[model samples]
Target: MADEKERRHQHFLVVAYGAQSHVNPARVLAHRLARLGGADDGSILATLSVAVAAYCNMFPSLDATTDGVISYVPYSDGVDDVSLPRDIADRARRRRASSESLSGIVASFADRGQPVTCIMCTMVSPPVLDVAREHNIPLAIYWIQPATLLAIAYHYFHGYNELITSHANDPEYEVCLPGLTRPLQIRNFPSFFIDVSGTERAKAFIEVFQELFEYMDLWRPKVLVNTFEELEPNVLAEMKQHLDVFTVGPMVRSPMETQIHLFTHDNIDKESYMEWLRAHPDESVVYVSFGSLVKFSKHQIDEIVGGLRQCGRPYLLVLRRDGIEDDQSHSLVENTQSQGMVVDWCDQLEVLSHSAVGCFVSHCGWNSTIESVVSGVPIIGVPLMFDQPTNIYLAEKEWEVGIKVERNSDGVLTGKELARCIELVMGEGAEAKVIRERANVLKEIVQATSDTGGSAERSLRDFVKTIQES
Candidate 1:
C-alpha cells in the first residue's frame, strides 16, 4: 500500500505519434515505469488512440494493468482513414485540430501535476515536438528506419540526387556521401523518391521531407534509433557524429517485448508453425513476409507466387491483401493451393527462430531485418519504398548476408526472379556460405545486446536515467 502511494506520486509523459512502431515501445516504457511505481500521474499521449484502443480490446491483460498510470490521449480522431503515403499531408491539413488536441493533453497533464518532461516523437510528427517545446520538456525522436536511410533522406533534402539517381541506373556506380567511401547507386537507394510525380500533392509531400531534415537540424534532439550499431556501423558512426544516438534495437524481440496486448488469434498456431518447421531437416523452410505496410499490385503478386512455387522447398508465408489491386490477383492463395501455408499474420519471432526456417524473404523493414538477423536467418531482400531500399542495401551490400531481387516497371517482383533469388540465398551461390557465417555472428551479437551489459540494456538504462534526471 505504501509502495502504491509512492508510485502514485511520481510522473512522466511520453507522446507517441500514430504508428504501432512508436506506440509499442512507448507502451513498454510506460509499463516499465509503472512497474517501478515512481509516479501516479504519468501520461502516455498517443496519436493512434484507435489502434491502441483496438489493441487493448484484443489484449486486455497487458494494457489493463497500467491504465491507471498511463493516459492515452488521442491527438487526432479518424486519422487512420487517411492513406499512409499521404499521412503527413493529412496531418498538415488538420493542423489546427491536431495542435489543439496535443496542447489540451499537455495542459491536462500539467493540471494534474504531471508536467510533461520527455516526449518521444516518431518520424516527422513535428506537432509533438512543438508541444514538448511549449512545455519546456526534453524530446527524443525514435527512428524505426536505419541510419543509412536517414542519411539518404538528408541527402535528398540537400539536393544531392545524383548519388541515388546514378546508383539506380548502375548498381556499381559507387556514388559517394559525406561518410561513405564507396559510391552507392539508384538500384540500392529507396525507389520512392526517385522521380517526383509532378502532382501538386506529391510536390507538397516532397517539401515535407526537406522540412523534416531542416527540423532535425534546428531542434537537434537526441535520437534513440531502433537499430543496432553492429548492423550499420558506418552509418551509425556517421549519424552519431551529427547527434547523440543510442542503437538498442530489434525492438520486436518477441511477443513479450511488444508490450501491446495482442489477441490470442493474432498469435495462434505460432507454435504449430515452429513445430512444422522442426519436422523438416535443418535450414530448409523459407519464411516470406512483406512487412506490415507495403501494398503490391496483382501482376507482382502473381510473380511472387510463381517464384515461391519454383523454390520447391517448404515455405511459410504471412500473406496480406494490400499488394494486389485486383480481387483475382489478391486470391493467389486459392490458386497456390497451400503449397506454402499462407497465414494473414503470425508470431514472427517464433517463426524466424524455428529450426526449420533457414532464410527470410522480406521487404526489409528495420524491425523485420533485425529480427531475421537476430534469429540467425539470412535474408532475400526485396525492398519496396521509404527506408526499405536502404535497409535492403545494408542487409545485402554492407552486411553481405542477403540477396536482392530485381523489380519490374510496376514494382512487381516476378515468380522467376523470386525463385532465383531464393535459390541464390539457399544454394551454393557466390559468397553464400560466407554470408551465412556472418549472419550467425550477427545473431550472436544481437543475443548479447539483449543480455547483460549489452548496448540494448545500456540504452534502456540510459533511457530510464534520462527520465529520472529530468
Candidate 2:
C-alpha cells in the first residue's frame, strides 16, 4: 500500500488573478498545500500560477523561480502590463489569452511527467473551469472573500435577484438574506450588485460573476473559502447544502512568516517606519492603509490626513506611490511629518502585530480584514467597492470588533466622521474596551483554527485526502 501511494504522487496547481489581493491568498493556500505533503511521504508538490505581469512584479530581480516550497509559473493574460484592464475589450482579451496560455501550461506539465492532480483557482477567469475539465483534473474555487459574501451571492442568483435589483438604488433598504441572521442594508451588499453605471466595464464585471455562479451551479466544484468555521458558521452551513464547502482559512501570513509582495515597495525607507512604530507607546499609534488597488481622490486624501491629525495620535500612513501624484504626496508627507510617518508601503502584518498600533483605518479589503482579526487589531472600515462593503458588514455587525465610518451624501467620508470613528475605536470608553476585548478573543479563535489539527488545518487535510483519492 505504501509503495502504491508513493508511486501515485499528487501535484496541485493553484491559479490566481493578477491583483495583489487575489494573489496573496492564493500564494498562502499554495504554500499550505505544499506543507501537507502527499498520501505518501515526500510525494506532494504545489505550483502557483499567476499572470505574467504579476509574476514579473513579484520577482523583480528575476532571481528565483521557486519560493523554496511551491514553484512559480506564469501564464500570459494577453496583456503583459501590470496595470489591470480599464475597459471591456482588454478584459475580454485577457480572458481569451489566459485560457489558451493556461491550457498550454497544463499540457507542458504533463509532458514533464508531473501532471496536475488538482487545480485550484481564485476568481481568475471562467476558462480555469474549462481547463480543469479538459484535463480531467479535480478543481476547486479558492474563494478569498468571506463566506457571507458567498452565501449572499448564492442567494442573490438563486432567487433574490429581482428583489435586489429592484431596490438597488435604495441604500437604506433591508433584506433578510437566507442563512444570514440579520437584515442587511442594500449599502452593505457588494458594490458589484448595485453598480448601475451602465458602462461596459461595470457590465463586464457583473457578467464575470454571473458566469462564475452559473458555473458553480452547473459543475458544482468544491469551494475552498478563506474563512474559518467559527467566523461564519451559518453561511458555511447554508453553502454546504448545495456546494462542497470547506472552511480552510484566515489564510493570513503570520508575523514571523515571510510575505511575497506583488507591488513594489519603493521610494520609502522601510526601516524608518518600523523604528517609528517602536518609538510609540503600546496601543498608541493608528495604522492607516487601503491595500494596493484602491486609488483615493485628492479630496479623500486630504480628508484622511485631516482626520489623522485631528485624532492627536501618532500614525503610520501608507500612501502608495501610484495612487497619488508626486507633488501632492510630498506636500502631505511634509504636512503630516510632525504627527505621523507616511510611506509608500511597509510590512503590514508586522505593523499590526506591533504593540504601539491600536486601531486600523482600512478600506476593509478581505485580506486586510482577516489580517486585522489575526493580529487582534480593531478596524475603522471605510469600504469603497467590490466585496469591501460586505467585509465591513461582517466586521462591524457580525463580528462586533469594528465600526463603519459613514460617508456623506456626496459619498465622501469627511475628516470629522473619520476622526469620530477613530476616537470611538481607540478611546478609553467602555464601548471601545468591548471592541478591543472582542478583537482579542476573535484573534485567539482565528489562531487556534489555523494551528495544527484545528478546523482549518483539518479541512485542508481532508481536501488533500479527497483529491488524492480521486
Candidate 3:
C-alpha cells in the first residue's frame, strides 16, 4: 500500500485551453488543488499550463513556479500572436500542436523532483487526453460549465442523438430528457447539437464532445464539474448515474484576477465603473456585458441601447468597437456613453456585486449565468450561442430568476420587446419583485455551497484523495 501510494505523484498538472472562459475557471481550480495539498507543508504542487492565445495572459511574475503556490506554465497552439482562426481544420491543427507542447512540459516536470500524479484538463481539450495516454497517466475532466450542460451533452451522445439530430432542422422541435421536466425545444438545445451555419462547425464540435466522452469511458476517469450540488442537486444526481461526476465548483472569487485576465484587455475603467455604481441608488442600474467572446449584431445593439434609454434607469453597457455592427452602431454606443456608462470591458463580478446593479443583461454563458445567480442579480438573458440557450431555459423556465429577450420575425430583437423584458424583471411590478427575491435566495445557496467544509470544497478534497489512492 505504501509503495503504491508512493508511485502516485505529489504534484498535479492542470491544462486549460486558452479561451478566456476556459482559463479563468481552470486557474481557479488550480488554486483549489494547491489548497488541497501538494508540497512539504502538506500543500499542493499545482502546476497550471494555460494555452497561449492570440492575446496571451500569461504574465511575467508567475515564472518562479517552484515556490509551492500554484506554478504557471504556457503551452502554444501555433496561433500565439492573434486569436484562433474560425476555420475548423485550423483549430484541429492548433489543438494537436498544443498536445505536442504539453508532452514536453510533462517530461520537464518529471525530470525535476515532482511528477504529476494526475492531470485535470478543461473542456474541448482532447489533446491533453492524448498526452495522458502517452504517459500512461490518469486524465480527469474539469468540466467548466454547469452539470446541466454536461448531462445534456451526455444524453445527446448516448440515447438522444436521433431524437435531436432528426429534429435539428426544426427550430421549434421539442426534446424530452429523462430528468428535466420542461421538454427542451431544438432552439433550447446546445450549439453543438444545433448547427448554425448549416456546415461542418457543428459536426466538428460534436466530434470533440464525442472524443471527450470516449476518453472518459476508456479511462473511467473522474470528472469534476464547476457547480455546487446544492444548486444542481437533481442534475448532479442525474448525471452521476452515467459517469463519476463530482460537483467541485462554482469556482469563483479566486485571487488570480490581480495579475492576469485570461484575454488581457487594458482599456476599461474599473475604478470609474465602481464609483458610478457607488453614486447610484441601490438596485437601480442595469449592467450589460455579452462576455469575452460572442459578438452582437448592429440590430441587436440598437434594440439594447433603445431599451436601456426607455427603461429610465442608471445603466452600464459594455460594447467593444471591434465587434460592433457598423459605424452607426458604434456611434450609437458612443452616444449612449454618457446616458449610461459604455466601456469595452469591466470586472463583471465586481459590477454584479455593487448595490447599484439591479439587473444583469447577459449572454447567458454558463460562467456569467452562475455569476449572476451568486451575485443575486436578476437576469435579462440575451444568449448568443453554445450552452447559452439551455442556460436561458434554466434561468427563465426552471429557476424563475431570469427573463430571456426574444428575437422578432426577421431574427432581430426590437427595442420595444427588449424594454418589455427589462420591465418584467427590473420594473416595480409584483412579478419583478418575486424574481428579485428568488435571485436573492439562490445567491445564498450558491454562497453556502462554496464555503469551507461545504459541498464544493468537500468534493474537491475527495477528488484529491482519489488521486492519492490511485
Best by TM-score: 2
Model 3, position 246, has a per-residue lDDT of: 78
Candidates in order, TM-scores: namely: 0.82, 0.95, 0.92
Ranking by lDDT: 2, 3, 1
Question: Least accurate stretch of 10 residues (summed lDDT) in model 3?
Answer: 255-264
The Cα local distance difference test for each model comes to 0.66, 0.86, 0.79
Worst 10 residues of 2 by lDDT: 325-334
Q: Give the TM-score of candidate 1.
A: 0.82
Over 97-154, each residue of candidate 1 has an lDDT whose tens digit, in order, gives 5556677777876796565656666566656656666777677766766777776776
Candidate 1 local lDDT, residue 284:
86
Give the distance in Å from residue 342's predicted Cα in candidate 2 to where it truly belongs: 0.5
Global Cα lDDT for candidate 2: 0.86
- How many residue pairs clash per model? 17, 0, 7
TM-score attained by model 3: 0.92
Could you say which candidate leads in lDDT?
A: 2
| TM-score ranking, high to low | 2, 3, 1
Q: Residues 1-470, candidate 2: write the lDDT tens digits.
A: 96786555878899998888988899889888888884336478889998888888888876667977789998987878876777877777777888899999999989998888888899637779778877888888898998898888888888998898889999999999878988999999998888887987668777888888888888787889999988988878888998988888989876777878876664257578888988899999999999887777778788888889888988999888787744464476654666798887788888899999999999999999999999999999989889999999899888999999999989888999999999999999998999999999999998789888888889998888877777
Task: Choose 1 or 2, whichever is better by lDDT.
Answer: 2
Candidate 2 residue pairs in backbone clash: none
Candidate 2 local Cα displacement, residue 93, angstroms: 3.4
